[model samples]
Target: MTQLHYDVVIIGAGAAGMVCAIQAGYRGLNVLLLDHAPKPGAKIRISGGGKCNFTNRRVEPKHFICANPHFVKSALARYQPEAFIEWVERHNIAYEERDNGQLFTLEGAGQIVAMLRTELDWAGVELQLNCDVVAVIKQHETWSISTSQGQLTSAKLVVATGGLSYPKLRASDFGMKLAKQYGLEVIPSRPGLVPLQMPARQRAWWSDLSGLSLEVAVTAQRGPRFEGAMLITHQGLSGPCILQVSNYWQPGEPISLNLLPDVKNVAEWLLDLKQNAQSLSGALKQHWPKRLVQAWQTKFEFDDHLANYTQLRLDQLGTSLTAWSIYPDDTAGYAKAEVSLGGVSTDEVSSKTFETHKVSGLYFIGEVLDVTGHLGGFNFQWAWASAHACAQDL
Candidate 1:
């Protein structure tokens, strides 16, 4: 078996691992980057519908949702969006900012992986993919990692394997597991940035409304508001707004919607159209889809015509139309999630260097950490920022 030795062993080849390797290499540390994936950064390639929205142009700590909200501040501030943008410019990667300050590469997401690969080359970081780590042992001043490739010894070990999001991408909770092995605390992990699964009874309705997308404000009970496009799916809801609010969603919670977001008075809108001799369904159809209007008509058939409906009834109908309530069957889970919400607890790791508070040279970063964000490229920023922080210290 081939034997390798390095000053630092980073157990991931994704965004965080690659960034850490570059940082450590430039600091004169022999860094080894390893992962089970063949190509590495598989998730990055498919992110942002292949364009790879790498970072939110406007990022703050609150953009992230964590058990402890303040933990992500230091790293985020240290490695700001401008710094990452400068790096992108230096690499000549063509990128543009989309709605809500989301930045994506025009040349496809592969450019990001390629750029990182190029940086790793310049930094002299050794990347070994298709290598599954079997075990790790803290051997006095250095750590020994047993892997499919071989045994490598290093003084510092950074776990950047990320969280379980897409199993197809080989995303795992190995980082959190590793942290636990070293006696570090870990927060419970959950699927985030995923679509909600509808009740079994609503399957027909979901299919009927499939491909129907509307710009609206979606909110979960006691959660944040997300205003964007929402799409009905076979499962339930999926789209920018649904995916955003899903990050803050909890099990058994009710989700609310502002269906007519731009229209202030739904009652007036309907009443004005009703006065034009339009049928109840036709009047609603003017503002919404014919199918949706039909569904609502079926729901309120008892009070058929607008003239027969009382003012209280009209107000109630408007309320129901404008503020729809929905309770999901469940989430689509990690397989469809953009990111995992919880992982290794931030309390166990340093907010600055991302190293474990109890362990001297061990660090955890990226999705492996408890820090998770909404669906607008915030996770990628955390990956870069946390990796940069650890690199600076190690």
Candidate 2:
């Protein structure tokens, strides 16, 4: 195998690795970008339904969660949404702003990947695709990366293998494994941004509710909560709300959904229509889809008649609507996940640089590290931020 030398050798040519390579090359370091994929940015190609929600305008440190909590500020502060926007403007990529300041390409996700490739090319970074790295070792201050075809040496080793979100996109646990090999702490990895399944009995009761969606606040007890649309699928609950909460969810806990949050006077509203006595199902039908009303009627004993029902029945129904408890079967697992949560532990690396404190010249970036962002382009922002952090120090 050919032996090549570089000032920096980056593994995984995804968002983080590519960005790191560009920054490192700008510093006049001989940079080599490696990935097992035939091309770069497969995740970028499929992200945000192909338009690519690149970043959010409103990004605070609170939008992220990590064991250390404060490890992301430095990198995120260095290359924030504005900087990325400037880069987009530089490339003249047409984009449109969506809800909550999410930026998407008017052209396509491919343009974003092209722009990244263009930056790497301009900075004189060597791009090596389809190179499966077998192992990495540190001798003195340099890290030697061994691949199927050749050996490369560098003073800096970046594990940008990302997470096992899209296994078809070449996701691997290599990053986490590498951290462990070097005696760095690693968080247990699991699926995120995925749907949850239902128990057999629960599925039967809510089976008719499949394909139904409604705006709600879904919160797992003692975990992250989200307010958005909840969708009932063949498996269980999905949609933005469920996906967001799954990142912080633990097993054996029930989710509480506020069906009518911020809505007051439900009892009074029914009372106002006392002139027309409607069945409990018929009254709810006026507000929700006919199918949804039917499903609820089948599951719960509701009092529809405002004048005929006792005060106790009315009060109970109002409370039930406010807090609907539903225990899901399980998450859709890794297949449908957008990203993987839990990775190389934050304690293992320097927050400022993402390099191992115990093992010098070894860096971890993007989803490979234990940092995860909320849905809506925060993950991509993380990819850019963490990469920029280590590249500056590299």
Candidate 3:
């Protein structure tokens, strides 16, 4: 049996752990960053389809959902997205701004991982990959961690072991379990930014429309609204708009989709088209795919020609087109989720330092800390900001 000691031991090598480790090491702390996986930044490597959306140009407290809404403000303000962009610039990692202010690598996500690894190396942080922690025991001032390799002790233990999202990437509930073990409150966690699954009948209908995508506005019942491209998948709804609304969606809640968002007054538009001797299918085909129009016509008993419909019928048709309501059976689950919604309750940790109120020298950050951001680069920003906050305290 071998034993090791360090000033800080971070139990995850994902976005938060790597950033925290590098920052702590730069502060002259002997840091040991460990992960069960053979490689660090597995999520980063696969995020944004391997390009890695590192951060967003506009990040605010309103963009995040947490048990304690104020928990993310301090960290996000201190370490803004511009700071990370500046850091990436320093590393000479060429990146480009994409839709919705998302910043992605020009080459590949590997460059972001490499840049972080280089920073860790230069800061003298020891990284131990494929080291699965078996046990964590705290006795007085020292924290003892038993891993697959050996026993280790640290003055401070930072659990950046992110929430259960991508299990294949070695994501686990270790952080939440540890929090509960220490008598800390943990919020119920679920999939966020994941595709919604439709009911059996709706699924069958949507399956026929699979591979079809269109721009629209989506809103969840009693939740936020997002306007972007919505995709019909074999299972149900997806794409940017659906993914964004999925964050706030709860089970049994209906989702409303405005199919004709650009058309303010559907009845007026249809009336004018009728005056122009246009057919309903023809007008719809101009905006929607031919197949989609055909399928939609089959589902809804709408007249083929606008002239055949009365004003009352047109008004009803307009209402249906403007607000197409859908009830999702469930989400795609953590397997397909971009991030987990809840974990260690933010009320149990310091908003400024990420240090647990119940456990001294123990911190929690990233997706495991009950802080979930909207779709796009907000989650990555939260990871970097929270990691920076915890590292500064360490």
- Each model's TM-score? 0.95, 0.94, 0.97
The sequence of per-residue lDDT tens digits that candidate 3 reaches over residues 88-111 is 999999999988799999999999
By lDDT, the best candidate is: 3
Lowest lDDT block of 10, candidate 2: 269-278
Q: Write the per-residue lDDT of candidate 1 for residues 1-394, one digit (tens) a residue.
A: 2336788889989988998899889888888898999997899999999999999889988789888889989999999888888989999999998999999999999999998999998998888889999999887888988998877798889999998889888888788778888788888888898998899997887778888887888888766788889888888899989998998777888788887787887778777755765567665555577777676577656344677667787788777777778889788998898888878888888898887889888989888888888777898999999999999998
lDDT of each: 0.85, 0.84, 0.91
Candidate 1's TM-score reads: 0.95
lDDT score, candidate 1: 0.85
Write down the RMSD of candidate 3 (Cα, Å).
1.4
Give candidate 1 regions above 4 Å deviation: 1-3, 267-280, 302-304
Decoy 2 TM-score against native: 0.94
Clashes of each: 0, 4, 0
Poorest stretch of ten by lDDT in candidate 1: 295-304
